[model samples]
Target: MPSRLLPPAGPARALAAAQLVNALGDGAFLVTSALYFSRVVGLPPTRIGLGLTLAWAVGALAGVPLGQLADRRGPRTVAVLLAAATGVSVGSFLFVRGFLPFVLAACCYATAQTGLAAARQALLAALVARRDRTHVLAHLQSTLNAGLAVGAAVGGIALHYGTRAAYLAVFAMDAAAFLLCALVLLRLPEVGPTAAPAAPGRGPRFTVLRDRPYALVTLLNTLLLLRMPLISLAIPLWTVTRTDAPGWLVSALLVLNTGAVMLFQVRTAAGVRDLPSAVRTVARGGALMLASCAVFALSAVDAPVWGAVAALLVAGGLQVAGEMMQSSGAWQIGFDLAPADRQGQYQGFFGMGVPLARMLGPLLLTALVVDWGTPGWLLLGALFLGAGLALGPAVRWAERANSALVSVG
Candidate 1:
């Protein structure tokens, strides 16, 4: 890659490279996992869904403990181990012959993936400056989008060929990606022996569990993360069922989002310096999302194909922009509010929202945004706005409760 294309040659790029690698694997898995199980592994869709749901739930529960391990031992060592474990677990899918085996493998895969996510965040918090973590994460997210797009394309090719060999190849590639991700991670230095556990654990091993304010913040963030499913589920479903726009628009809107993030996420993140700025940015992002919901509602109206396309495009743009803002702000807040030594556990707890969102968002959004139509879209937007606004008070509460840090907001 050109120098301009690379993040400065350091842990940031190393992290980005590792992210891109796993994202490629994840991309392949996301595109083909369902089809592979149904067509080749011989599991029903309902079983597949149930197994994955169970797996991610297990994974979400596993995150904090794993992260605490990272803090106890070392983020780099734990991250590398978890990365390799994820590769092995994903590879386990190739041997799965029944739902029981599949569920077991899926659980292992999800747990390792979830743990790796927390470990990586812990590593980022350890290696990157507090101020720059959000920007680095932005770059990682951009790399993730790029890698997923390419991996999805690879999966698409396998689908086009419609062969068992091609399908297996996608899984194989995905497994390899995580293994390669582990290798990339190995190049980075450990963030040192984990700082001695704060005061040798005065309370619960995972204090983050008892942290009501952080939990509240995570909850609100999880609500905002509904936009995540909105991207993957609601918008595509809405486009297909409710709008007159062409089918290709489904993909185009996704591309618009991916491309926009790649182009703009870093720049968008530059303004968020601390908790207060993060809060304001999130609020503004919420308003943008509110407007986006309204625009999407317009697409359901009786309009020319072009008009609907325009509305969808406008909505998509606003949604992505809002996504960039909230994501950047959330990253900063997740880091800024945590005790410096407890980043691993804090990040682990904070990241629970992701798996939770993945588990819950689809079912919830399908009911609210897709099935309910325009009314649902508006209602969901209101939910987003409300959540974004709630973060301010939640952070205030967190700041007051967390004695290790001063209330910056």
Candidate 2:
């Protein structure tokens, strides 16, 4: 690992440790869970898919209110509790016998996981300095990619064995990881309520929800976030179907992404100091994504084995570079634009972009980039560019609105 990839020893290290433990479990579980549900639990793929979709929907809706709870109850405390709840949720999967039990456990799992993310962000805001928060977040993201890689390697062992016991063991390990994460989080200092409880009727339930500029920010961030599925979905599908590149290139591409992020995320984040820089970084990222899309589309052109491989490798490099920039810039923008006292709910709200991207990115990208081919890639790229271009004006609108509110107060 590069030294510049993460922050030095302190609370940030502790936070990274907790994140690593949690992600290790998640990577293992993710590799094994669909198989476990189908084979071990005797549920069909359709039921498993439906259950997960419902779970994510419930989880997405729960984020803001639970984040607000973290703000009220002390973020560290809430984070710890939610981590434990995640453990309980995963453990419940052990005895799931039918679709109903599976749905219930899945919902619990998603809700706890979502709430834990929000709570941890709130705690991070309280623990870390404003200027350092995005850098630390980059460290956390790097740690996540590293941990997931390791855990997926471990899960490969279970996948090879293909036994009920092997699947169960993965679940057990995942549960233990979240439980241990709860304990690790206890070492962090507490942060009290960010703001006093508002009197009834004094304000909206979620001020973050009502903040139109923030909502626009989240929407644009979500647009930029199409990168998430680009690697996991668009590239792989495009490779096997549209391009002559070998199937193994998929794994190679993934390795490039994870390794690059693990080494360069913090370095990329170091350049983004405030809103303007974050915006420019994201815009640059968008441009790079457009270039990557063009290269990927070109790979589909008639080419020899080595030529196709070379194009794909170059495209992968460009994509990962854009991914790092977009992630780093979004971290700062999401944190910087939010009110300090509302960091929890605001982060939770901003975090919606992730799930939104997850839910819609696949369907949209598959239709546009994979199925539609060259034009689809170009359209996706242009969408990203438009979002990047729009961000500057949107942010300016946000600043003016915020200033007016401050003047009114």
What's the TM-score of every candidate structure?
A: 0.96, 0.97
Each candidate: RMSD to true structure?
2.2, 1.4
How does each model score on lDDT? 0.90, 0.89
> Could you give candidate 2's per-residue lDDT for residues 275-388 as a string of tens digits?
899899989998998999889999999989888899999999999998898888888888888888888899888887776677677779999989999999889889888898
5-57, model 1: which lDDT tens digit per residue?
45667998999999989888888789888999999988999999899999989
Q: Which of the numbered candidates is closest to the native, going by highest TM-score?
A: 2
What candidate 1 gets wrong by more than 4 Å, as runs, is 1-4, 195-201, 404-409
Worst 10 residues of 1 by lDDT: 400-409
